[model samples]
Target chain A: MTAAQGFRHGLRTAIVSVFALVLVGTYVSVGALAHDFGFSASWVAAQTVLIWAAPAQVIMITAMGAGASPLEVAIAVGLSAVRLMPMVVALLPILRTPRTRGWQLVITAHFTAASMWIEALRLAPDVPREARIGFANGLGVAFMSVAVASAVGGYFLAFSLPTALVAALLFLTPSSFLIGAIRNSRRMVDWLALAFGLALAPVLALGAVRLDLLWTGLVGGTAAYLVQRLRGGR
Target chain B: MSVLGDLWPYVVLVLVGFLPNEIWRWLGVVAAHRAGEQSEFLTWARAVATAVLAGVVAKIIFFAPGALASVPLAVRLAATVVAVIAYLLIRRSIFAGVLCGSIALVLGGLVLAP
Candidate 1:
């Protein structure tokens, strides 16, 4: 590549690093979580690669930690993922391009989680429609590679890391996540999502049953949307 | 071959867990073509995703094990809000906010530890 091409490539990578940090960090945390919970390494890697959502992953593992049955954990995790359908609908339009192959689309789609899609939506307007998908894939690829690497590392290193530090790192992704949400929320709906989820999580945590993550997403998300609508958020 | 035999069940279990997520991604590819910025579905997705992230944040902050748990809840919460707000204040830089937040979390833990 030419100097300019190289520089742009580097710049794109640099921008992705901002996002990839948490993604990779989350991988490490999840690795530790899975290992601590006695999950198989391959299972952890597959879900992190495929699922790409930490909360749902955490919920599944945590439920297991709480001795929930495999069927129960599966149901809880599946319910947590119901929200992704909307994310998929909202995000892919920006990335859809004629030249973009279906397989490529499938590969890149692995990276389309909530945070990535939300940011891409803001940037999609400035991008040509056809190239949007390419850009999204390019963005998504960085995280995929990182997740793969961190999973490998975390799976191996899970036994070495101290308990306290692992917990700290696990806590870090969400802190970084909240920071991302508060900063990136351009619309009123965005604000409501941030505040409502933040407020309702602890209450949901107190639930004796499983599915706290899903319940929080449902009740808190609806309330936030309602509150936003009441304030004329549309 | 032996290693493969040992790990086969895990491989399948992993497959089952990820299949649903892959469906979501393929669906994203289709939506990339059909949806628009102002689409109501987009708004709903954004709200749900953001809320989930927030809930995730709440869980990590309050419930995680180890040194972070040793810190006063008030201090940790305050530090998170301050760090995240500072991230926005610094022109929406994720790097800036996260770096500061991580620093604050570690430092706060050290100071608050008994």
Candidate 2:
């Protein structure tokens, strides 16, 4: 497949996927919350473009609302984003081939979020090596468009939307992500990581607010890795 | 200038929100070039990422930040449990899971509204 064809395929898949609808619902919630917190619509839309990750965006906006300093906001957002490093690490290598340019890898990394990453990882194998970059980029562009538009629209709709409906919308991302994690689980380590992370988060939240996720990921992931090693499983 | 002051929030967002987040992706791109995809280090990284995301999911559900916090924690937890069970028993359909979960949340909020 050529780059264009791969791009088209990915674009079509993301546009039609059930996950895209969930993204729309989630970002609408994000936009509404940002509006409630007195952020301009452009601010939320820009966040959708730049941060792209829902969890990090939520953290930054809420922290800002709570009057956290800029430095504090950066630290919290950065901590939430540490997960992206590993996702990009796992994904870029799959998309890269002999002809893949350094610039392409750099550009693609910006578009790597959970939605695009999952789709790309699942779909890259079927794409020709040379076209994988286009495919992933297409997914990134489609999701970004959907997310940003929904956010801006939600900002406008925030006034009329009921609190109950907004609450329901906020539930979309976490439920969808949890289900996605369960679907992606293929091994004991994966299951253990999910279990450990879910159990550790509430406990860690009782202590420090800023570093809970960082600790959860580190401790839970390490525990899973060690358990897998002890079981002699790859 | 007054214009610069007006633009300060966007400026802060770019510096604080965009840069901090994008730096990790850049780091990953640099690292992926050196490490094979299936290497043990990459495996560990994947586990770490997955765990972190799972933590985010739990955070949003259990200790929700915004409007979700308005709904009682028990309702939120029950909705999530219902969603997971529905997803597993219903052909692993993500749509079904999210839909059921969302319906439960809305209904729970209504029933438990004070």
Whose lDDT is greatest here?
A: 2
Model 2 segments more than 4 A misplaced: A65-67, B2-7
Q: Which ten contiguous residues of candidate 2 chain A have the minimum total lDDT? A: A206-215
Candidate 1 at B6: error in angstroms? 3.9
- Model 1, A1-234: lDDT tens digits are 332343344337535656677766667767777888877787777767667776678777788778876677666666767667656665665556556577766655676775566556656556556556556665665566677678767877866876446545655677766766776677787887788888788777876547676677777777777777788857
lDDT of 1 at A139: 60
lDDT of 2 by residue, A118-193 (tens): 6687778888888899999989999899999999998888668878887887798889888988888888888999
Q: Point out where model 1 deviates above 4 Å.
A: A1-16, A34-44, A56-70, A97-108, A162-164, A207-210, A227-233, B1-4, B20-35, B65-67
Chain A only: TM-score per candidate: 0.74, 0.90
**Positional deviation of residue A220's Cα in model 2 after best superposition, in angstroms:** 1.1
True contacts kept of each: 0.63, 0.80
The local lDDT score (0 to 100) that residue A109 gets in candidate 2 is 93
Candidate 1 lDDT at A164 equals 49
